[model samples]
Target: MRQRLAFALGYLRNPRHVGAIAPASRALAQAILAEVLRNDAQVLIEVGAGTGAITRALMPALDRLDRFLVIERDPGFARMLSAHFPELEVLNCCASSVDQLPLDASAPVTLVSSLPLLSMPKAEVQKCVSAMLSLMTHRPGSKLIQYTYAAPHLRPFANIPYGWRWRRVVSIWANLPPATVWSLEQTPRGASIVH
Candidate 1:
């Protein structure tokens, strides 16, 4: 509780850096990360991994051979993440600069972001999303999982090209304000959007 309050206060003071008030609940964090792992994505990029609520759940789901890249802008949180999950390659950088990170091109990338997209400017949000999509190797089943405290359809990735489709995997009312997990998939050319 104290940590959550501190996070909230920090965010209130600096909205751009401290995206969200509280860390995700264990159940919601696990559920969100599980959707990405279920698709067998070899490389996973986690954005805004504040204090590593989802990171903790993500590590166990991945195999020893798999790689996890965690991007966090807050140095304090990044240091905490490094201390907690030394196995992961934690990058103290913004999500928009994801492409600049040293990632393995051979592996399929699946981006899972907890960044508060709605709170940020549209341009910044689009850039971050685009960067994530561009980083993917574009295999048969590459995906991006994003969780938000809003209705699934309401939070549109509008800047994304029509070739991509978003699906609501699950919703967790157990979370503080409740959150919906949305999976972004690239549809085949000329194929209808997948619900």
Candidate 2:
């Protein structure tokens, strides 16, 4: 309940960033990450980690060698995440800077985003999607996971580069406003969107 209050206050402070009235329910978080496997990727990056709702869910699933990187733009939320999850490497910066992170080039990175893509400006969302794609190491199965309250058929980007594909995995109705999990995978250099 305390965490929910903090999340609500954060949302009130900046509706555009926080994006939701309450923290994500455990069920929603679980559904969003249902397909994630700790052994599939070397790095785990969670963007828009508001109050560690999804972070808490990802904690137990993470492999011992996985590098957990968290990106939170809000200073207050970042501080809270740092305090609550001392083991994680929290990066207090905008999600657009995902490509700028000092990551290992050879290691595959799996990104999980809680950002409000439907509410954010299209250009901003494009920038984030492009940056994330640019930064991912396409070692066969590297992918990105994101949940949205929008329609299940809505792809993150209408015209992405030739190598990426996104598909809706599941719709979780237990959340406050409900959401659908979208898994984006990086295929070969010339592959197109995966219907």
Candidate 3:
């Protein structure tokens, strides 16, 4: 399809950023969507939404959302996302600036990320990870959904915040190279890594 072709071209341009040769599979998208709908989120923010694969899957959540934001570092992909999803606001910026966004402090947020964190530069990843954690800290009950191509047993972060934890949602064998989804959120007691 045209969408997949565009995604492939984007991947070819920057494999490190695009992170995959093909767009996320429907099964993977469904898995993510299922997690998104598990709880009501006031704000929906997606980072590194390459060619809007997960973005399209997130459309159903729009009806109940207060705001929907798509962050794509690549300008071309940002424009394509904007064009394909005119209903949402697509920002062309690094995920490191996530804390700079004008998000509500009281409203809970759900951040869906497709960024190649492990593949990106260490400094960039640190900045992004710190900012994301800060953003979630400011907005209580906020959760982050991130999928990775790493091993099944690996946690998103080896050491998370003291009160936050990462929960494995599902593993998508259907996807190219496969992927594992993890949700990071504040635990009632303290931080713990659960597989």
TM-scores for all predictions: 0.87, 0.90, 0.94
Error of 2 at 92 (Å): 0.8
lDDT of each: 0.77, 0.80, 0.88
Residues 1-195, model 3: lDDT tens digits: 988899888887887778777889999998999999986877999999988889999899899899999999999899999999999989999999988998776788899999888888778888899988888888888999999999988877666777788888999998997999999987866444442
Task: Put down candidate 2 lDDT per residue, 76-184, tens digits, no spaces.
Answer: 9999999999999998998999988887766877889998987777787888877887776444456888888877677755665567677778887878787788887
Query: Each prediction's Cα RMSD?
Result: 2.4, 2.4, 1.7
Candidate 1 vs candidate 2: the TM-score winner is 2
> Least lDDT summed over 10 consecutive residues: which range in candidate 1?
152-161
Q: What is the lDDT of residue 157 in candidate 2?
A: 56
Report the poorest 10 consecutive residues by lDDT, candidate 2: 31-40
Candidate 3 residue pairs in backbone clash: none
Which sections of candidate 3 miss by over 4 Å?
189-195
lDDT of 1: 0.77
